[model samples]
Target: GFQFQMGDGGAFEMMGGGPRRKKPKFPKGVPKDIAKSMNWLKGTEWNWNSWRNVKFDKDGTFDAPTHDCQGGFCRWSASPEGKVYILWGDAGLHELQVQGAMPKEQDQAKMQGLRMKGRRTSDGERCQATFQRVFDFEAAELERDLYGILGLPDDAEEADIKKVYRKLSIKYHPDKNP
Candidate 1:
């Protein structure tokens, strides 16, 4: 059966586009500030009822670790090839984890400026999480080495790697006052 009315005495037969898609983008020349404002407007006033349509706040980030620990399953995880993505919150930083997709160097850089989308869990309750959390430089270096998990070459021997690791550790160690 088709929905006969939109509550405004308007025929609501044949629902519009399917509820799932790549999600819509703002029209051309629409400033981001305006688009965000418009989104807020539609949400706050029109009661577009997106809560029933999409998940809670369709445009939120998914932090798997935070979510898993906090019991919030609305964490988004997307991977293409060896590249993994962990979108944080709408305003939080997006952590891009690139592994050894390339055999050269397993570089891990954290950029703090990116927008994220909302995530949905098995339950209906919604939670918002931000991605940005300042980390000490030493922690970052360890994370960088952990990337790709490929490890250094076997022929290089453990001594070489240890030397490099020590150098990095000294440079970023918090007590070093770097």
Candidate 2:
């Protein structure tokens, strides 16, 4: 038997008690940034209305209820800039354009908070099937030079971007100084 605990920032802490639990190793050749994105996605439940919810796991595996198959496994992937690509057994290929910073290391809690905030509805209100669709369309668009802010080259790896972001956050986050 195994127990899952929600750790700080909404990530699950595995069944271990220690000063520092070991992080799972990603498969070889997977970029750290991509691995981090995948880890954030894994084990997190997603819902599109009440019937189309799914939970992705390691190695891009997921189980979803579909009309044709009753229920079957599926696969998913994310782009560098955070677009989601899904290959459901019945629906063929679907691409989702996610607006905002893509999920990355140490940002799981923040991202989760945003999602929760967006999905809040008054009691007795049914969740809209077009929630994500409407939200993506209505989100305030922004144009920023991300590479310029990070002082990185256009082709910088995800790991490098993360390192710089952590350093900058430590230096500039309001709570850090106060």
Clashing pairs in 2: none
Q: Which ranges of candidate 1 are over 4 A from the true structure?
A: 1-110, 123-133, 146-155, 158-178
Q: What TM-score does prediction 1 earn?
A: 0.24
Error of 2 at 103 (Å): 2.7
Q: Using lDDT as the measure, which candidate wins?
A: 2
Cα lDDT tens digits for candidate 2, 1-178: 9989755753345434645323232233423232333345544556655456555444565445664323434565655555455555544444454445545432334555323212212223223221111112111112234686689998999999999999999998999888
Cand. 2 TM to true fold:
0.39
C-alpha TM-scores of all predictions: 0.24, 0.39
Off by over 4 Å in 2: 1-38, 49-51, 67-72, 106-108, 113-178
Q: Residue 44, candidate 2: how far off, in angstroms?
A: 1.2
Q: Give the lDDT of residue 70 in candidate 2.
A: 33
- In model 1, state the lDDT of residue 80: 30
Please list the Cα RMSD from the true structure of every candidate, rounded to 1 decimal place.
17.2, 17.8
Q: Write the per-residue lDDT of candidate 1 for residues 60-110, one digit (tens) a residue.
A: 222232323133333233333222222233323222332222222212233
